[model samples]
Target: MSQGVSPAAARGLKYRALRALFRHFGRMRPAARLRLGRWLGALAYRCVRPRVKVARRNLELCFPQMSEARREALLREHFHALAQSVVDRGVLWYAPPEKVREMVALSGYEHLQRQLDAGQSCILLAPHFIGLDAAASRLTMQCPSGATMYAPQSDPAVDAIVREGRTRFNDVHLVSRRDGVRSLLRHIRAARPIYYLPDMDLGRKGAVFVPFFGVPAATMPSTAQIARTWQLPVLPVLSHWDAATGRYHIEVLPPLEDFPGEQDAEAATARLNALLEQWVLRMPAQYYWVHRRFKTRPAGQPKLY
Candidate 1:
């Protein structure tokens, strides 16, 4: 017979167990691991009813014209994509650099390189997507140096893993979200390409209510402000997993010309939303729909989960 462990000790043991499982899964073949991940996602779909509901509600709000059956199918696919991305974190963190490189195919990277080569500052406007971490990993390998912000995870163990995996490939300046935009600007002014995720509701502080999928969404206007203030070029970067090929694709599109030249921050933010809308439509299931995008509603408007 064994003595029962204390609650804190039990929690620590559980975390270690999960970490070991991730390492084991990371050693498996890519195809096999992804298949297992999809299965896990299916299990999560059945068990995590609250998150499933959130995904369904997001779909309903964003794609109002979509039929119930169609929306449900999209939600199921989204969960599977989300699961695969989450589980693949192990491979991204522990697998060899060559192995990680093999799993991604990049395109339009020259668009970014050209700007960097000319000694011009540029911002990679990356929206929230399921395969974002994979994309970031691949990016750190190819780019010389860069900067990005992250909201720190509550669990110290998990946070450490995330930081190590992201910065392992290249010399990246990881700024904490708590430090605010001032820290990010210092790096940007130093000619570091900032991988900015500009499409989220962080309340009304520095954000403006803009039309996202035809609904009023609180969006950050910092992208436009930064571009105008520093005369930096804005390039849109999108990443998605190709189910048919079982690989991730990262695309760096051409820079937006004449952006934020005479327009105010609010107008620039609206334009940013329109660009993100196009990308979301291209791969509806791969976008990060589980997030509460419409969490902060306009005053006098009812809240949306």
Candidate 2:
């Protein structure tokens, strides 16, 4: 959910309870907090079955070649990662900045630094992962400034918390999805790297049908357009929460060579989707599967979700 509460989701209860829970959770030592997170994760796994059902269908569509038994196992592991990520947010949101930096282990940061050092704007192609917020929030600790796209939450309290968490450090610009690409360009022009996520199913406006895990999913093609417009390089970044060690691993990969091809959105969109597939293979359980990725069907096709 990227800290954004969906319209249909249960609201006041979650944020209010977590607000009180995190107050104490933030005070606990890392090891102890993680232990409690795992316990809460177990409880969430048992309680949030409806969302689990959505994730299950997503797995069935993406990994049909894998055995059903294996998918079930992966599903269980995913919930554990999901719940652990939420619990760790107490540190991301309320704990000291030093603790936040300590908990996040970022690799390939030099790639981003190299670009910024050379006075070039870079775009971080971040796919949907449970540890995404952990990675993004941590990046702001070291980055001078940056901007990212997000769908605003419906509830005021939830939106305030999420906005505060993201902008706590670096005064990073938080552009609403309704604000469009112009706001992003302004940030890039100011030398702030745009943290871009193009994997979600946002319907047919600026998106095209692309093979995400071999399924024709509606995906935004704007990554290429934006890169081409600004003459910037597109580098991929992926993050995952390790439940065992209670640490977030953020990998900022090098740029995709010859990106923003002549076909631009179409070809570039396909390449991005292909990259997401490869990343999903590495951390299958860590990918965000609850989203209705293939919600936008082509001309006459029925919905997959």
Least lDDT summed over 10 consecutive residues: which range in candidate 1? 1-10
lDDT of candidate 1 over 214-271, digit per residue (tens): 9999998989988988888999889999876668999989989789878899998999
Q: Global CA lDDT of candidate 2, please?
A: 0.83
Q: Give the Å shift of residue 207 in candidate 2.
A: 1.4
As a TM-score, model 1 comes out at 0.93
Local distance difference test values of all predictions, in order: 0.83, 0.83
